[model samples]
Structure formats: structure tokens, C-alpha cells
Target: MFKGLCRLTSVAALVCSTFSTALGAESGKQVYTGTLGKTPIVLEVNADGGGDVGGRYFYQKYRKDLMLSGKKVGQTLVLDEVPLRGDQDAPHPTIRLQPKPDGWSGEWRSPEGKVLKVDLQQANIAPAPAATVPFLTTLRDQSPYEYLRLQGLDLKKGKAETFMGYSLQWWIEPKSETTLFEVVSGYTAAERQRINQQLMGRLWQEVAGKFDCEASAGETFYAQTVEPLWMGPSTISVSIATEYSCGGAYTDENDMPLNLDVKTGKTLTLEDVLWLGQGKPLHYEREYNDATPSSESYDAYSDYRTKTLAPWLVQQLSALYPDEMKTTTEREDGCIYGDEQPWTYPSWYFTKSGIKLVPSFPHISSMCRDTAFSVLPYNLIQQHPGSAALQLP
Candidate 1:
């Protein structure tokens, strides 16, 4: 399952192109909007003078970037499209443009010798993506990618779902769909409203990131799903799985779990549920929940994660699932579930049986992630509750 470690999951630019837009500066970069024939396109060009010109362009409909790199000849720019696969020697499309009265007029020639008219004019940058939800950037900072992707989309509502007697309505948008649910019966009316707002905000982040990544790479792969793992008088917990390729070397996936307090609707963190810290656990900053602590405090927290918490998890899970704890070979692609190395930086969620620990591994061993072999029983939580006053079943 895919989750947003909030690993600050980044969407990088491929070649000659980046996730940058024109915003009140002449940083050698300019954004243009026009048409490659009948197809509308957004183009960025950097003419910083060295006779070198580079940028990215995407069809407005597709929203996937096509890298551009070439040279400026007199009054014209001759930009060759770089292969998305990074094969410089491979055949690609080419664009030649000269300054016009309004913007730039160009011709795009395909490798197959087909030619098309390319007309581009300066694009007026729109306001940041505040349309989905108010203060949408609270969960994570907005990027040029977000603005570029969201500016054109008109989100519509999809079907609603009733799960375990709970009503959840789908707020539909692409490159994915998400839901919003109010805890009418489990929590107080006011608290439920607040909790629903928080849930919707988080869902917006997940869905928005999906669209952002999707737009970044025209051929980008993206999918997301949220499953209610456990919903009770204690808390409502859901597992969000996101699998996407956002202009990276390879595709990525993660499982970000959301656990909420029934009474307060407060989103529960690992530190809130199970802290092995000496005194104060990872501090939750003012607004951003994914925000990290300073170096000194973070060093201590790292010690607790790697040295204290991870090893204990190894022991606890080993006693329960001995077979799963073993790793074969990197070549064999065996997931080492018991390896305390990954458990240190805990990725956990509330499960029906217990608190399930999801381990993260490097690219080669990424198959080792989300194995779900390690779950600490709820009875253990009853015995050793963290600083949180909430009760768990």
C-alpha cells in the first residue's frame, strides 16, 4: 500500500525542464500559452543569453511535460525535444520560434517529418490553488506543479459510499477520487464537523498531489485509494494508498494512515498512541503535522526510533510472526520484515487487531515495505498507553 510519508514526496523535472513558472521575475525563464496547431500547450523557455535555450512544454489536455533544449540563432530559438527516456541520441521532435508582435510564433516538426504550426503567447499566471479547500496548502506547501495542474480543472462530486453504516460522499477529481465523511454518531456534532474538515483537508492534499504528479508527467502513473481499516468509539482510522510516478527515476508507492480521536477528532500520531521517548516525544508543531523537530531534538528522537523503538518492535513481532522476519537475498527480492533497520522510522496505523507497523526500505528492497507482519496488540496499548488520554479497543 502507498502512503505519503509526506517523505516530502517530491515531483522532479525530467531534463531541460523543471517545475518552475513565471511569477513576477525575469529569471531567464518565461511561460507561454498558445497552440501546437489545434492542441493548446503551456511552454516555458529559459533564454538566459549564452546562446543556450531550454525549457519544458506540455499539451494543455495531457499536462505532461516534454523537455526542450536547443540554441538561439539570431532572432529565433531552435529547441529540440529531449526524449522523456533520457536518450539524447534518440530521435525527437523539434520546435523553432521567433519573437512575434504579441508572443512567439513557432513551427513544431516531428521526427517523422510531419510539421505543425506552433503559436505561443505569454501566459498570465493564475492565483495559487485555493479553490479546492480554503488554506489548502496547510498540509503541505503548494508548488508550481499544483498551480499548473489545478488551474484548469473543475472538480465535480462523484458517488457516495456507505461503509460499516457510515455515510461517506465522494468528492471526485482527477487524477484520482477521494471521499469526505462526518462522524455523526461517534463524536459530538461540533467535534464531528471539525473532524470532517480535517479529514477533507487531508484528502484534498492526497488528491491534489495526485493531479500535480499526473500533470507533471503526461505519461505519469497515478492511483489512490482510501480504506477504512478501523472505525469505532475509540477512533476512525483509514489507510491511504498512493502509487505514482512523478517525474522520478522510478515509480513510488506509500501508505499514509490517518487515525482520529473519537471525542476531539484530533488526528493521532505514533507518538500520541505509543511513545518510547524518555519524556517529550516528537513535538507536533503549530500547523503542519508532518513538520519535523530541530537537529538536537531530532537526534534524540532518532536514537529512540533506531535504538529503542525499532528493536523492541523486532522482538514483539518475532514472537508472533517468526517466519516473516527473515530476509533471503536482495537478488531473490525477499522482504526482511523483522529487520529493525526499517522499523526505526516507524510507519504505523491503527488496525482492527492492533497497531500495524509498516516498514520502509530502499529502492532495491522496497518490496519489503507494507508487509504488515508486525502489529502490536491493543491490549499492549491498554497496559502501556502513551501520553494521549484517548482509550483504544
Candidate 2:
């Protein structure tokens, strides 16, 4: 696999430009299947009239987007690579191709003067196909998909196992150690498919994100552990902890919990399970990749999470689990998970008995966040449940 997405050089004149190739913009774009020398690629060139040419392409093997731009020079279309944000050293390649009876044929030349033969033929791509689109095609389908496919995403299914009476299949990106679990049995085929889509889409992001990081900084050291927290009848949940270092001064670590409603294939949020806000529950992130949440909406959500829910959650947990809530120097310099400060906006997942919440802490107290001690009983979650019609076990 390619180490990273190529970037633009210091030249500002040859920079990437903005153009929408969204859901219904296929008319404006033309897809091509060809090769830049021996390597295969799927190129998208602008089809809207005039000599001005632009679009993007991905290596058939890499499945990552590399932008292109330029205009027609007589019979030949001359295009320059539009470098994205990445490493300092970019080849800044250029392509010169002339339209032939079948398609287009040209030469790909790099800044270093290395040249290779370029050949291309239009590809039939559908944003919305009648049948199940191949995973490779969906990599750049540009459809209103349930999940956003990132550049350099290579999804591979690994390990088949059983957890809590649920048949599990793991989709893994070995390089980054990114793992996503798919429920293989239990529900109808349609329901299982919907769930698999969600899992695979997320897997794409994790893998692509790693490739992106490596491309920008070169050879990132990434490791992830997917902990299955729940595989109950009503909910499927997992917690992912990632630690990465991409030529940085220090490694960075973060954790996220994915909780999906087993029935509807919807991601369940903290507010969805337990909310004490007088106003409506907050949307922490977009439900789908295509959504554009305004800054104002995000600000309101931040306020609600910090001001409203954080304190209320602490109060509730404190009242319920007073012993666990008590802070002592014994635990990671007194960085307790039940501490009101850290528990304010925790990443949580569902469990058979209760809700397992892990606190967020400063780098100095990261160890405290590792141990999940603040668990809220299912009884409370059922009391102030949000809009989702969930059956609490």
C-alpha cells in the first residue's frame, strides 16, 4: 500500500482547487480506467465544456484520491498534479495526454524528469446503482453513502469468533492495527447487511486516517485495541483506544466508544441513553458523513454537554456510587474516574449490567482514564432516555 497521499509542493500556483463532485454531480465529471505506466488507476476528469480540465484519480491498488487540474492544449490535455496537504517533498507530477479513437494516451512526467506512458479509458461508475456496488467502486462512488470513505482505505476482513452469543467477524487494517467487528448472525440478512455497512465504513475511516497521517508525516507508529463492551440483544457496542506517533515529539492517545442500536443500525449517543437537560438532547457529531453541522449548533452542544449534562451526571453517579466516586491519592495521583471534573464528558458504551464510562483527562492523568470505574446503573439510563426507542436489558 502507498505510504501516504501525495501533497502539493511549495508552489502555490499549482494548488488544489475546490469543486463539488457530490451526489448528483456525475454529469460534470468523467471517470476513466487506465494506467500511468504499469500501475493501474481510475481517473476522473472534468467533463463540463471548455479547455479547463480538473478532477481526481486513485490508484486501482491504493484506492486513494490524487487531485489533477489543467486545461486542453490543442489536441492534448495537459494536467498538473494538485498536491494536497502532506509531506514537504512532493513529486508534483504532470500528465500530457491526447484523445485517441478509443480514449486518451499520453505521458506522465515527474518533477525529477522521470517519465512513464499514460493511457486511459472512461469507466462506468454509478453513484446509485441498482445492485450492490463493488467495495472498490464504492471507494469513489461519490454517492450519499452511509459512511465517508477516506483516502487510502484498505479494508480486510479478519478473525471470525463468537462473543456473548453473537457471531462476530473482524474487519481489520493490519498496518494501523485498526479493527471493526461485524455481527455475522442473529438478525435477518437485511439487518445484518445494514450493520455490516456501518462497521465496514467505520473501518475504512480508521485505515484511511492512518494512511493520511503517514503521508503527511511519514511512517506513523499506530496501534489500536478494539474492546467489545457489549453484544447484547438490544445493543452492540465496542470501545477503541488508539495510540499513534507520526514523527512527533510525543505519542498521542485517544479513545472512542461506538454503540449501535442492534435493531435500527443507528449509533447511540450518551444523551440518547441518559439526558437530564431541560432542553432537547444534543447532537455531539453528525449522524452521517454528508451532514454539515453549523458552528452555532456545535457551540450549543458543547455548552449542554459541559454545563448541563456533565454536572448532572456527576451528581447522579455520586449519589448512586458514593464509594466509587470518592477520590483518593491511591489512584493515579487522585485522578479518579468518578471525579466530577473528568467524568464531565466521558466516552461511554453499554454493558449488560450498566453503562461503562471512561473519563477524559490531561496527559499527566491519562492512566486514570484507562480504568473505567464510573458505571451508571441501567435503571437511571431508562429513566431519562432520549428519543431513541431502545429496550434496556
Candidate 3:
């Protein structure tokens, strides 16, 4: 994605230069970052032939991207804002500014009849580039099910930008029921379209909600999906990773794993694939609801983590990376060498050869970068006590 942005920057620069030289016009694209009133903003101006201007202006406080269009007269440029969703009755906002060698200084008129002064410095940044290639593509009518497609969204305000991105490279199934589609009935073309729209709509709303809140708080939020791992004949797993900053000293990173059963179109929990001791069956919904983390279901997870999963993981890690464990223990005092708090359960995904575990940042060590990952070979897991329940041959 960075490479694509770099390419766009170069192309835009070339086009601007060509217009300036050939047409003898003030034609170029410049990005400015600063604040409008109390809110941060990112404004882009693209001036073309005959002083025709158009670009995008973003409001960080509201996660709104307003279209800019106007004309340059003499040494000053005047641009008006078009709302993201057009409403005919809303008052149109306008900006009048003069270009300086270092940046732009302007006056802004709000839709609510308020006027404010704006001073901005040229932001040495690249615009969020569009996704040109699909992560995976399905031919028309080639398979019984449509391939999972990748999508990207960007919201920029001043120097801050939030990107919601997904990758479909791990979608290798030729034809099978997906968790997103199983809730709806029928597989006709129209039904498939409806299912796809609903699935994508939900994802968009989730990201947009976060973006809107963070914008007002003077922060940025980004979420993306990692490459999926196929666990077995019926299971597919992927991790949704998120980074957020609410004008804090540091950003927070989190990971949520989704282990879906392709056959049943439901998520597979620990109880589904492994026995959880003698008791009534336990089932966990795939979706993670922030509002319900304090509920009974979470308590059940906490118990399972402390008593069963953590111990088993320690044994496996000891056998896999003994030297690293020994060194870590020797470095810290009062930190029980091998017994680290296992609150952040490792998100696991299965491959043909083994099961890969990805623990969120700060789970294993405070300084670990990104996420700590390890793979337990299929043979090794099969040797464990409850391997028979996994249904792997």
C-alpha cells in the first residue's frame, strides 16, 4: 500500500508540473495539515487548467470528507465544500485562502454561519491511495459461491488518517458456505447480492463508528485483517488487528481472532474442537461485543485460560523455545520466569503443517514488537491428551 501511495505521489507531481510548464497556469496539488477552530483538518487542493480547482477537505472531528470545488482568481483561491451525503437544504461552507511558499493561510465559513481564521503548514504526506488489485478474484459463474473480496476505506484529517482494510488472499475455498452468507436463505443471484451487501455494510458501519468517535476525540483508528489460516476441512481462521489512539501518550493495539466453521457457518470455540472437562457443553458466539466483556461468558473464558490453556501452552513453549525462555527469566527480577499472566489468549490459526499461535502485543514480553507468533506442528498437538477431539486424522 505504501508503494502504491508513492506511485500516486509521483504521478500527481508529474501531472502538476506538466500543466504548469505547458499551459502556463497555476496548476498543482498541495496538501495542508492544521486545525480549524478546535478541530484538526487535512485539506487538498488540485488546481487545473483555467484556474479550475477541485479536491477533498476532511474534518477530523466528525470523520467527514467534504468535496472541494471552486476557482482561483488572481493570487487567491476560493473553494466551497460539498457534504459527503448531499442535502439540498444545508448551508454550503466556503474557504478563501492565499497560497504562501511554505503553506496556506485562509478564512473558513461554517455551515452554521460561524467564521474562523485558518493557518496551515504544508503537510509532507501522501494521500491514501486506492486499491487497484483485488486480493482474490472469482470469475462470473465459475464457482457455486462467490470469492471473498477485499475492500479498503480511508478517512484523512490533517496529518491523521484512519484506514479500514481487508485482505482476501487466504480465501482459497472453491465452493463452500461462508459464515457471512449462511444466515440468509437461498443462493440465487439476488440473494447472494443481498448477503454480500449486508456483510460489507456491517463491516463498514463498525469502522465508521469508531472513526467518527475517534475523530471528535482528536485521535485515529485503523483496523485490518491478517491473512487467514485454514485449520482443517471445516474451519477457517483470521485475526482482525486494530490500532487506536485517543490523543494518548501511546497507541493501543488489539487482536481478535475469528475461527469459523465452514460447514456449519458458525464459530468454533475451545469447547467445539477440544474437550473442556466434565460439564454441560459450552458455546461461544464468534462476535466479540465490548459491552458484554464483563458478562458470564467472559468469566468462563478467564477460568479456562488460567486453569487449562495456559498450563498446556507453557509446556509447549518450554519444549519449543527453551533457550529464549531461560534468558527472559534471567533478565527480570520478581517476574516469575515461566509463569506470565495469560490474560491475552493467543489467536490461533491452522495451516497444513501446524497450528500457528499469535499473541497480542505485551502478552509475552513488554517489548515484543507487533505480535509474538509460534507454530505447533500437527504431530506435536496430536500427542497431547485431548487431540482426539480436534477430529484431525
Candidate 4:
């Protein structure tokens, strides 16, 4: 399924590139290059074309041999798409580094294949080029989507601007109604709303049944935005601003469901901040609820073994005397039942399938006269020795 979709998406790319390139020009580069730790890694555009992605060497620290394929549309460097070996989803295009008489320069393409013209001819030529200023690249698609409206400024083709003496990049772009008939077909908005309300009511009932609910309410709103970033190989830097609002929340005091502020806004709550501080914690992991589940309820392994495991046994017993194996059917209550049982000595027989057991008694039956046949040894082994048992009875 994924393979088919990927193929379809790739084919779709040919026609989609035009609008995507224009819309894409607004967002910067998706793929990027930088360091993982101390080791330098060339991060490039992935097939999904979202942002900077690392290759196998990103982990092993193997710098790819930057082989120049030639120029694209003149002085523009053309990079070869190297088939990377490692855990990457697909191979990516290499960063084409074009060296002039003075310094190295190149153009970087975002994941979407929209190229960002870059030049570092005048910067200080040290061992390697440093990422002077980052740009607002592309807004990544979280999932498969349509109507991708990338919100931001625009740039012209064949035109160039400088940031810390570098150019900015660019790129671009449920329902149900049915009912049990109507109840199942929720085909209209009203029907869907009714269904959703009923569902939420039932869910709340179940939750309230399990635990006391101090409040109950919900709100719905829509939001979108474009965030900027400075993504190198290993290190990632970015800024985000979102527009959103809470629909509503239910509380016991409001018999008339009070609606929360349904308005859009933005808050920069310290997500894009990272520090290599002194004596500070290397990693400060955080979780939402702000509390941890207690471990005291857990028992030791030995306790579980004695209480839930030890003394449990399974055994198979040989035929008590001898038995007759038969397949028979009967009408029980109203259902027709099939039986596979062994007829034993005296007059009783039993059959079982999985967890069900059956008891039956046949009056002599047609086998009484020929019961003396000597198939006893096989029957004893197979638990079908009714012939041998009938001889005694």
C-alpha cells in the first residue's frame, strides 16, 4: 500500500512541481547539512522533502566524497543523487559545492526539490563554511493533505538576496453522514453533530461511571502557521508562532454550558530554546501530567510465580478400560449438534471439544452383535477400544 502511494506521489510530482515550486519558493530549504555531535555530516533533502535529513554516515560520521557532477543552467552546481546506505528511508541529492578562484559556493535544494541559490564567496574561508544565518524554510506536512496553503512572503526567480551574506530559500503546497440508515448514515452536518454529541455523551457516561467527573465540556477551533529554523546536521534550531483557541470546557457550576474564549492567538512558551549551560542537566526530560505513576502496587517476580504459576499441571491419561470412538449427531433443545465421543464400558460415553463437554448413553445400538471383533490393541492406543470392552460387557 505504501509502495503504491509513494509511486503515485512520485508520478504526481511531475505536474505538481510547478505550483509547488512557486508556493515552495516562499518556504526555505527542507533538507540541510550540519554536524551530529562533533563529527560533520552532510544532511540532505529526503524523499518526503520535509526538512534536513541525515544519511547513514550521519551516525557513522563518514563525510561523503563531494563529486561535482557539473553545472546546471550555467554556473549553478548540479549535485548527484547518491544512493545512501543506512537507515534512511531513501537516498538524497548531495550538496553541490562549486569552488571559484577565491572560495566555495553552491545552491541548496529543499526537500520539495525547490532550489535555494547560495553564495559564500566573500565569507572568511576557514577549514569549512559555517551557517551564518538561517532562513524560514518550509512548513512540513504532518500527514497526507490537500489545499496546502503555505503562509509567508514571496521572492522572485533569478533574483537574489543576502543573509549574513546568504540567500533565503523557498518551496510550496473528513466527513461522514449515515445512520442505522439515518443513525448509521450520518450524512449531514446536523446528523454528524448529533452522532458526535451522542458519542461524547456515552463516553462521558462510561468515564463518569468509572470515576467521578468534576467537569465535562469541549471546544473546537482551527489554526495554521509557518515556523522558521536553522537546522544543521545534528543540531536543530527553529521558531514557531501558532494561531488557536479552546472551544469550550464543561464544569459543574455551569448548567448553561459556559463557552471558553473562542479566539485565535499566539504564545512563545519556550519550545525553541536550547542551552549548553554550565553544570546544567544534559537532558531534562518532561512529560505533560506533571506527575508519575506509583510503583508500590507492583509485586516481586517470586510472588507472581507462587500465586499465579506454581502447581499448575497438565496430564493425559490412557483409556481406563477400552472405548469406542464414534462421530454422531443429535438434536439438543433446537440446535443440531455434532458429537465426537468415545463409548466406554458399562453404558456411558463422553465427548469434548475445546471447553465444551457432552455425555451420552446409547441403548445397545447396532454394534452389540459384532462387538467381539479384535481391534482392541489399536483401540487401546487410540482410545477407541469399545470392541474389546463390549466383549466383557
Candidate 5:
């Protein structure tokens, strides 16, 4: 069920107005912190039954902005956005919470309501996420796309830098001299290699070009630290601090794109690169055995619709001919590969299923969409007079 996706799923800012020491702690190894702001594009999920299911993604060039935070360590965050019908606008709740020694307890209320409630603690506070290299600039600034495969990042120098008026440290300082560092001494050779190889990069050229970089610092560095304090079985405490510019591209609410041309047929752009992701894989083992008690089955093909079918078909094609298919990872590689996934429907499936046209990623409604699409392409080619049946193991 969609709820299972929620189960699989699942920060702060300095400010102009500093809070009293009681509300804000700035000294003595204050709990590490992080903040994610101005996530240019808004993600609207329908929350049908699982992750990204039955959701219509409207890539608003510029409309609403997203931000959140929690106090203390080991807290849980539940963000719910229910799309209302027929002029009825649903209210969304932005909750801040931390675990109390007594039990799970935190205050929650809608932005439009005064009816606040204190609920029992169901989970612990989640730690901040890892700080990684910004994708676009990394790709553009790095070596020839052909040689830039994903690999471990070596922290040559580690230190801190004050960015955007905030005094922040660099967890994995780049190999440059101007950076800072505090090497934790206590590990074997294997441990040292593991620490040295901790690297993260993003694919952002498309998004960055669509929206300009907000700063002229040439390049800014950030840091992150994670501590394993259980918020839930998989949850932990995370503290992060990074530099972000307030002057980058902003899309007007009306400027968002309702459609996406993901397949090879359409023109490739930085926007596509920004949110590109491999179609979700239906992990048979996880879905059937490891999923939560209330989890739904992972079926690629059952009921069929173009929306439900396209991504599934593409995923199958990807599995069948992985080296040739376009994936977010490969796209980030920036190499000249063969045809990309066309935004348009391949001819064979449409005729058999008797459907016309399909929406892009966020518009998908069900697993069936992916499943139907997966088999349809191969099925079409197989039916061609002398063609042999395509095999998928």
C-alpha cells in the first residue's frame, strides 16, 4: 500500500533575529544542526497508498517554498499535503518535534488551525542528512564526462568556513589548502579508507542553468555530522550546516511545467537533469518479504493505463538493456550516450492497451502504469512477424 512507501521513507537555520539563549543554544557543542531551504521546485504527492503513487507533480517555476526543523535530538517529522477537490484547498501542517524522556510527545497543528494536540511519541527525532557536493557545478567543473563515473570522495583537507554569515565547519574538507579540518584520530587502515572514501555528488547542471547560481563565491563548502541515536529502528540524529544563496532562479506559480518529456524523443534540458531519477524498481524480495505488515504487493502489470504503464515498461527495458538505457546516474555522467528515454509513448503498447498519451514522472498514479509500460514495449517487438520474443529473466 502507499502507506508502505511512507514507511520506507523517510533541520534548522541561523536567523536575522537570534533567539534568546533559552530557546536557542549556540555554545558548548550545541546539538549539531542543518537546514534545507528554497527547494526550487515543489513536490506534490497525492499519497494514494505508497511512495510517489497517484501523485501529480507540478514543477512550479516559482510558487511555494519548503522549510522545516525540530528541537532536541531524535524527533520525527510527518509532512502531509492533501490535494483538495473542486476549489477546496487542503491545509498542510509543518510540525517541529523532539523525543521526551517520558515517551514520544510533541505538539502538532495545521497552519490554519488553533486546534493543537500532543500525541504519544511514535518515533525518534531524525538526524540531519549528509552534506554532499552540489550536482550541476560538480559535473560541469569536473573532468571529461566520459571519465567522471561515481566514486568515493577523498577528504584531502577538513575544516570549517563561515558562509552566508553563519560560522560552519567542513566535515569532509576538500583537498584544497584554504579549507580547515579536525582529524579524529583512532582507526585502523580499513577504517581510514572508509572515511576517506565517503563522497557524495549531485546532478544539477539542468536545474542550475534554468536558474542561475545565487552567489559569486566561486564555490562554497559545507559540513555535516551524524550520530546514531535511535529515533526509530532506522532513524538517527543528524546535524548539518551548508551555504545557500537566496538569489538563484525563482519560478512563478504559473510558470511550473505540467508535463515532462522524459523519454529520448524530447529535447534534453537541465530541468530534466535536476529531478531525474531511475523509475522506481519493484524490489521483489523487499515487497514480498521485508515490507511492513500492511505493505502492498509490487506488481508492474495488473490493471493498465498509459500513466501506470510507461515508467514500468521503461524500467524493464532498462533492466533488459541497462548499458543503453538512460538513467539519472548515467545522465549525470555527462557522456554522449545513445538515445535517451523518449517522452512520447512507444507505438506498440498504445495500440494493444487502447490508450492515448501519458503524463511524466510526478503525474503517475499507480504501479500498474510502470508494469504495463515495462512489458508493452518488448511485447510489441515480439509480435512483429519474424521477430523473436524478447526475453526478461
Candidate 6:
């Protein structure tokens, strides 16, 4: 289940403020979840003493969050979307919902000028299963030093006939009392929002684009950010991993590491994490296991595999596991040890103690081997050349 926060205004406050004479009530917020024209949605409404209304509307289908603001004019409640940055030119949808005895009914207008009849009944607010609901979890909490939150969104289409799906789980740090912490948190939030838009737009274009595939042959895409790593006073880091299968022979997996300077909101690259000399750092492009001959030459791929990253990684791994490497390398099919194969970017994350490296499946050995993780302690890293640049304690 996804866990996150949904800060809503109390229904009592809304009633008393919007219809004080008709229904006397107290103040606060309420959340309602249901469907809007077959799309699952969540609405949070807040009411103030002056009859001002403000809250959030979550379009679960696309995992879009729209800020809402409106007021009760006579017996009608009107709400409109407050767009985010770079969205000013886009049409702003509006909701004209009227309160009913059991729930609310309204009409929703799309930016494209399409209209949909909305029928929403009040229901108990409960966490939906992640497998089914687009956004199943939300969290809003604070610690002495920092506050943390998470939100999850999933989309599934053509499921009845084929199987196309996309999912995103992310963290949201709305505010922080610390200046540097707040800046870095805002940067991360903005980056996540940008990625969400790109991914969603890509998925739609792929599924409905000119080269659309048959519904019987759909694909699946999934991505999620792991638990964040926040320890040092000046650094914060997280990893986002993705897996996709488009009726291919093998599913593809990749990861993006997000390391940030807590003071400047600047992203830290892999080189920043590792102490590299003036020469180029270890880098290699992957060759898919099911690559076609029209792709780049195999010799170039092999050269990168054996000459660049493989040798360096081998030396490090040997230093860390000398005894195991001696016996393991003697065996046939013994860990391709960096050979021509479908390559995935190694996944890495930072911790207070060390930097952890997660080798993808088949990267260290064969598919039979359990995924292996290697940790280079901070002390070891400090011993490397130019390590002083890291300024680690």
C-alpha cells in the first residue's frame, strides 16, 4: 500500500461557512474518493470562516494533482484548477459541483472543451490497494530536523484486451524549516514533477501514437523511487529504478541516482560521488541482450566491456572478495565478468557508512546467481586519490 498525506478541510467547516444559515457546523476538512467519468479521483476540500475554499484534486488516472480554489455562490459551489509553473497557457478546467444530501454532483469541463457529468457520493476514506488504485498511499509527517512525504500513482489501460500499465511512486517534501534543506527539497520536488509529466506523456503517445500496436500485444512500464537516504547535514540522495517490457525477449531495467547538495540544490553526478582523476571516469553504453545486427559494431561494445569498466571493477571486486574470486573464476561460465551481453546501468545508493553498488541480473554472473550488492566503506573511499575533494567526515 502507498502511504502519503492528504491534507483536507473539514466538511463541518465547509458546511458552516458555505451554508452557515442552512446548516450550523464546526470547522475543518474532508476527503472524498470515487470516480469522475470512469477515472478514479480524490478530492480534498477546506473551508475557512470567511467562506473561502481551497484544496487539492487528484486525477488518479493520470496521477495529476491540481490545486483547487473556489467559493459558494448562492447554492452552487464553483471550483477551478490552479495551474503550476509552465502551465499558464493550458486551459484551466473547472468544476461546478452542488452539495447533495448524500454526496455531490457536478459537471467537469476538460481543457479540450469536453464536458463530463460527475456523480460523486461520500465514502469512507480508506487506502486503496496499490495493485489496483493509481495512488494507493500518501504520507505527511515531520521530524525534529525534517519532514517527509510519499505519493504513489499507477495507470493501467487496455487491460481487458491486452495489458498496458505505468506506475510512479515519489516523495514530496513540501516545506522545510532549514534554508538549505528547503532549497534542495524544492529542487527534488520540481524534478520529480517534470519526470512525471514526461513519463505520462510518453506513455500516452506510445499507446495511442501512429505506430500503435494491437491491443492484444500491449506493454508494461513501472518505475519507483526507493526510500530516501538523508544522513549528513549537507547531502540527500535517492534512487529511481525502472523496468519495462514491450513484448521483448527480455525485460529492460535501468536506474537513475539523484544525489543533491543540501546547500545549493545542485545535483551530484557519479563522478562527484567517486574520486576520479583528470582522465575520463569509467563509462559504458549498454548493448541489449536482444540487439539487432543493425546496431553498433560488437567490437566497440566488447572493447568498452573489457577495457574500460570491466578491468577497473574487477580490480575493486577482487580487492573486496579475493578468496571468492579465486574459486569462482575457475569455473566455466564463471561470471561473464564483464563480457558482451545486455548491459544495465549498475544501481547505487549512499548511506552513512558507505556507498552501495547493486549489480543488475547477469551483470556479476548468470541469471542463476542471486543479485549481489557491494559496499565501499567511507574510509576506503577516503583513501582513493583526490578523495579529499569529497570532504567526507
The better candidate by TM-score, 1 or 4, is 1
List lDDT for all candidates, in order.
0.66, 0.67, 0.47, 0.23, 0.26, 0.44
Q: Give a tens-digit lDDT track for model 6, residues 106-222.
A: 888877888887776543432322321112121111110000011232132211211112122322222110001112223356553433333322222222211111111334333
Task: Write candidate 3's Cα lDDT for 1-393 as tens digits.
Answer: 111112233322322222221111123666565677767776767787688888766664443556778899888888887654447457788988887776778888987879988776655322222321111111101110111011112222112211122212111111111111112232344533333333333343334335443433244544444433343444555555555554455666665556655444444564555443446444443333212345687678667766876777667766786654453547553223256454236556666666666544453343443323356676776654241245552
**Candidate 4 on 180-216: residue-level lDDT in tens?**
0011231344533333232222222222221112111
Candidates' TM-scores?
A: 0.68, 0.70, 0.44, 0.16, 0.18, 0.37
Which regions in candidate 2 have their CA more than 4 angstroms from the true location?
1-33, 42-59, 62-107, 110-113, 119-124, 130-157, 173-178, 320-341, 362-364
Q: Please give, for residues 1-393, the per-residue lDDT of candidate 1 as tens digits.
A: 011111122211111123433442345567777899899887878877789988888786876667899999999999999865556697888999989975899799998999999998765442323222333443223333334443344345666666666666555554465544444444567766656656766766666666557546335777777777777766778888877777777877777777777777677777778876676667442233345567887677667777888898888887887777765553255676657888877667777778888887876667778574678898876665676787676
lDDT for residue 66 in candidate 3, whole number 0-100 = 66
lDDT of prediction 1: 0.66
Report the Cα lDDT for residue 171, model 3.
16
Error of model 6, residue 97, in angstroms: 36
Q: Hey, what RMSD does candidate 2 come out at?
A: 8.6
Best by lDDT: 2
Model 5: per-residue Cα lDDT over 192-292, one tens digit each: 22222221121122122222222121332222222211111111111111223333232111111111121111221211221122343222221111223
lDDT of model number 6:
0.44
RMSD in Å for candidate 6, one decimal? 18.1
* Model 4 segments more than 4 A misplaced: 1-162, 174-219, 227-236, 249-280, 284-393
Clashing pairs in 1: 2-254, 2-255, 3-254, 3-255, 3-256, 64-218
User: Taking the candidates one at a time, how many backbone clashes does each contain?
Assistant: 6, 1, 2, 34, 44, 14
